[model samples]
Target chain A: MPVEGYAGDGHFRQTYNDIHILCQETAKRIKTEFNPDLMIAIGGGGFIPARIIRTFLKVSDSPESKPRNIPIQAIGLSLYEALPDTSEEVVGKEVIRTQWLDFSTLGDKNTKYGGLLGKRILVVDEVDDSRATLSYALQELQIDVEKQLKELKVSEEERSRIREATKFGIFVVHNKLKPKAGEISKDVAYFSGTDIEDLWVDYPWEMPDILKHDELKRQDDEMAVKAK
Target chain B: MPVEGYAGDGHFRQTYNDIHILCQETAKRIKTEFNPDLMIAIGGGGFIPARIIRTFLKVSDSPESKPRNIPIQAIGLSLYEALPDTSEEVVGKEVIRTQWLDFSTLGDKNTKYGGLLGKRILVVDEVDDSRATLSYALQELQIDVEKQLKELKVSEEERSRIREATKFGIFVVHNKLKPKAGEISKDVAYFSGTDIEDLWVDYPWEMPDILKHDELKRQDDEMAVKAK
Candidate 1:
């Protein structure tokens, strides 16, 4: 069975501690499983977690090697073509508002991977929902590396580093419930801090919504009394 | 003696560990001084550091109290009216790109502080340079809270809670060197993980430009060889 999504009854409220610990664990997994030198974080979702994971990677680094100085690149990906007005419009839809592989929004306009010729790379995000986002990211990276190799003339050693560099995906939560189209390539591995069911995962970042909902309810009650 | 800018010989590079440590210390400062129930991260700069500090607050909370369940809100602010064409465009001028207080870019559409009547709030970000961004954030937050309190109808206790709630500022790096306009009210304390002499602090998040520079130099060398 493909390790995709999971089903569950109740929602999972991930606390700050939960996320911090998961990032630590994810860093550990990356060290042993991937040992990546570059971490590419998908913006918004992956940005915060990726930073935490990078910090954790320092502690997880081997005693001998200078702590892995894994440089991070942030890329923005949005499935929506336009912002959906209604909840119904967003349900079960993947209307891409922004391109999945936009280079313009790449967090750093500088490096452009000229220094990453032979580095193992890790692409990270908060969740792997339909798996499409991660899939697109992996494919684009492969295409980018291939293009760079063909265009740049470098020593055989540098060329080999570019050719042999590996890429993988990391997520804080991997939803094993929603069935996605395809898996990340066999050669490219994926790691998650935690596996969660398809139910809603309430993150600390979204607490404002919960607070706002309560406020609206109180206002509605007061208005109803006035109407009566 | 206004803290406006720092003159220095070399660039100050801030490593991942430096940031992580600073965030931890900022959390400690917040515990003793502000004890805020909410954290608002100024986007781009404040997002990551704010989140890390928020996490640290959980650990810093007193043993008897439920870990400070402080909620976070993210708002984006850009000083540039237009992006500079070359790196030189941004050196000396404090360009105004976006509105001083862009609430539209606030991460959540739901709350908008409908429930913030009595809650203590903290505005967080990476740096407090020139202090314009932090100054604007403090003023806007004061205005928003005042507006919400006047318009919304809630219990006397809730109203009191809202009125008593205070706002503070937190930063990973507070460059007291670059002077700006008015300060945040003395009642609303500001906390920083560390302070540095006014100098160019190169963050890991901004590593791309450095990498890009190396790439450009290599390309230039190759071109020179061809010309020869």
Candidate 2:
């Protein structure tokens, strides 16, 4: 049952078809489920799924109206600590930020969610394993919103008006059912396309040998059909 | 031959396989040809291809070293103008920037680009139709580099040192052979996966009906084989 190179029952390499279908199906429910105005994608992993789901999130006011895509703000996070030189080193499990939201253009008064202050924002990622990255992103975003509110120096009532409108939600293609290393706020709306086992997920993008990876996926599908 | 819904001889729909192969093939050349240190992905369209290409570009220092991804900075641009209300409106062909580089987090002294001052940077996008967006991006980036140098008050010799090392390049999946609306700097290196005719390319992400879109692609490939 083991594929060459990737030898283990714990590894599950997925094909593009399944990921595409999952996004499409999830978008159908996400339409009414979250109905988010903005998306904060944890970069690299979240980029593809965010772009795919944006196709479904588009809305046109009328027959002639242009269907607009929901804006995506990419935030890059890595579980591993990158060394100064290109040498092998895995020192700690700390999260390092490579990128964050561009606040200048995004913070204009005319623009929606000025500095991500008050709007329905959805944080998207490929998978939720330790829940460390998601928790960090949400907490940082909350801090950003709070800081912006104070800096702008708006009236207390005016501040409360935006505060009530502001909300955060989460969407992931796969959420591994395991003991999470981090915690998430219960108040934030959560949606996962599929609940997966606490195993090693070999995403299509990370496959060094895609052909072999896909072949294994095909065989798995065939075995599943035969078993049924 | 024309297909239902998307009826036209000019509109060509691509399957995921073709796109994936194109990225793989292009990455092979990009490794030696461009040898870029960083990537600037034009969001949405560029997001998918950039992620795919990054998979191939990674290089580990040693047997135990982790193959690090060439960091991708996303910039968002759109051809259409967005209105306050969700109403139909076709504005000029001007490119509106939705997102730009995050100067704060990315401008660290130890960072690779050092505010993109002196580095081999590759700007990636899905297609090159009008050549307007790509041109604008390069020019703006040059301006940003100049502004940073001035603000930092870098010495003349030091400025020249980084400036000589600094270079810009481009990579796109499809480049339509047509008279471009905008012009690019001749000195800047350019790379396109494939040169396509002036046809409407329906990318995998834009397919509203993916099943039908893929079926049409299969039929097209079969016809090509039969003709051969």
Candidate 2 lDDT (Cα, 0 to 1): 0.76
What is model 2's interface RMSD? 4.0
- Per-residue lDDT of A31-78 in model 1, one digit per residue for the tens? 887777667666556667776666555422456535433445555555
RMSD of each: 19.0, 4.7
Residue A73 lDDT (model 1): 57
Write candidate 2's Cα lDDT for B68-151 as tens digits: 777778898766446422111122377878889887656554444478877788998888888888888999999988887776
Candidate 1: list runs displaced more than 4 Å. A1-9, A59-69, A80-116, A154-161, A209-228, B1-45, B49-124, B129-228
Q: Lowest-lDDT window of 10 residues in candidate 1 chain B?
A: B81-90
Sorted into a CAPRI-style docking class, model 1 comes out as incorrect
Candidate 2 Cα outliers beyond 4 Å, as residue runs: A1-8, A62-64, A81-92, A107-113, B1-8, B61-64, B81-92, B108-113, B152-155
lDDT by residue (A26-69, candidate 2, tens digit) is 88888787787788888778888898888778766579977777
Best candidate, lDDT: 2
Residue pairs in clash, model 2: none
